[model samples]
Target: MLLGMRDDEEMGRITLAQVAERAGVSISTVSKVLNGRQDVAAPTRVKVERLLEAHAYRRTTRSAREAPLIEIVFHELESIWAMELIRGVENVAKAHNAGVVLTESGTRHAPGPEWMEAMLQRRPLGVVLVFSTLPTEVKQQLRSRSIPFVIIDPAGDPDPDVPSVGSANWNGGLAATRHLIEHGHRRIGIVTGPEDMLCSRARLDGYRSAMTMAGLEVDPDLILFGDFHVEGGYDRATEMLSRPHPPTAIFAGSDLQALGVLEAARAHGLRVPQDLSVVGYDDVSIARWASPALTTVHQPLRRMAEEATQMLMRLRAEEPVSTRLELATSLIVRKSTASAPTGSPAGRGGARS
Candidate 1:
């Protein structure tokens, strides 16, 4: 009605009457602003801003973009093993023009002065924790500050509200275990990750599920829990093999752990596949080069790292995303696994009766 608009409500879309009623402003006041009147006071300007935001106004080219600062906290930065993950995360952050600050918490000095104050003072766009187990107090502090976060290998439900992105750890574990089962190996065993890691438990659950699905009853004695590194894998594998009727097939929860298992098997005069078939989660680069070409489940490390970066950027923009992001997992077959060894269990065990 004001500017060559149609008289019908639907023809030209929402009318001033509708807008005025929704905004709780007088029709005359709306007219003054529409007609380029300069008589509005400070309160009216504030009201207009609120209305625009409530209506979900899309930002046009002129809106200034805020430069976001992101923090990546790690428990251990000195390990060469963690470098690949760091590279993936840092590369993604740089591509988005976001500032990345790296800090090692729970280090020598007990995270004394510097770490506690970092998140609260800067109020970063989001925090990315790379396979670091954060203490409960630290988690609560972040939540209290209303900070968003993504954890790579966190121990528990990251936060009821914040979104998290990581590879399908449980499924990865299942896939690795299933591959061993498919190759006619029973006596399947596991060398797990740290007890505190949700990933460790998830993988263990997957192993149990896979065995159950195969109609095989799991022997609690066959389960060996350990750390994520190669040494931990070796130690746990040794314990499993020491048992009288040790596992003929072993599933190591991580690639590093798998390497250790391989070594332990060799030390006991056992040949891979011929002696003990091995399957490993996390098909890291070294998995292929390991003796007998270690068969493993491939986790998308770079992809997961990239996703964490992207999620942080979107959250900073107050954008929408899935609360629980899960990635795909697949099993990769290699020489490390083969037909069940002769004289071992069969169908429910390895080769023989």
Candidate 2:
């Protein structure tokens, strides 16, 4: 009954019951409007929304607003790369006085509809997606509910309307390739992520660009495509090294892949930098722990995650944010690479057991 009366008891007190009464509707109807539920009749919804704006019926309390909860979804939860991204998001969430919820998609790079349904039910302040994509229907649902979202290192080409944060992958690839070229490696091999992934394509393009600039004929026999994982790297490296004229150096699309390459070298009894050189992308923590610390292109995965969270915060506050953000990538030089051997021996038939 505390509609618009000014009294000490009712001061700044606007409850859903009062709103429902004033709008000539039930409390459930008011809830439907608040939740952006489409089941309600258009006229009833319009009346309820109009009254809500007039009386300013905020759904969140002061405490809830102060420490809003946010959600981050990822394709997988394994590996140091994912951990670094999580740490970055946690840091920003702490600074913003927000709490974070993590969800694993449990599927291919795209989050399924069940994940969207859960997110809608929880109604977090905003969402951050890493290496995942949303379906058009899910995007519409989020929009109807006024839930903002940002993507980090999207698995594919994101919708133009979606906001995203990523590193300069092409530049990273180019730099990694050029570093080997500078060290006198002409027959350089490359193992990249899936061919369908945008990041993989960009990195591969960058390598091609660098090779073209150096006037090195890209050897089709040395280029391989696989997932950005250790196994992929191992398989690709093993196959390439067993060729008739194996590459003197190899560029892996990820740190995990680089480790696999190292294992492949060992299995072949070839010493790193002595028989072959290697470069990797994403200077994850494990890179430093590798035998000959990885020479890599620093993708700044943590920074990208942090920036994406900040952008989501801005969106949650109804503030402006850039549609897309690209952080700079740098080359981290380590001991993994060396000048191509003066008298390179022909490739053996295959790696040793």
Q: Estimated TM-score per prediction?
A: 0.70, 0.80
Q: What is model 1's C-alpha RMSD?
A: 11.5
lDDT of 2 by residue, 1-353 (tens): 11122342355746778888988889998876666566889899778766666654555322232227788888888856788888889999999787888988756556766677667557777888875456665555555445678888634466566898877888988999999999988899999989988888999999999999999999899889988889999999999888779988999999899999999999898888777899988998888889999999998888988998998878766677888888999999998999887764344333444
Prediction RMSDs, each to the true structure: 11.5, 7.3
Worst 10 residues of 1 by lDDT: 57-66
Clashes, model 1:
3
Which structure among the candidates has the greatest TM-score? 2
Q: Across residues 98-159, which tens digit of lDDT does each residue of candidate 1 receive?
A: 67777887652133335656454455666877643455545544543335577764333454
Query: Candidate 1 has which clashing residue pairs, if any?
Result: 345-349, 345-350, 346-349
| Candidate 1 Cα misplacement greater than 4 A, ranges | 1-69, 78-81, 107-113, 116-125, 131-148, 154-157, 346-353
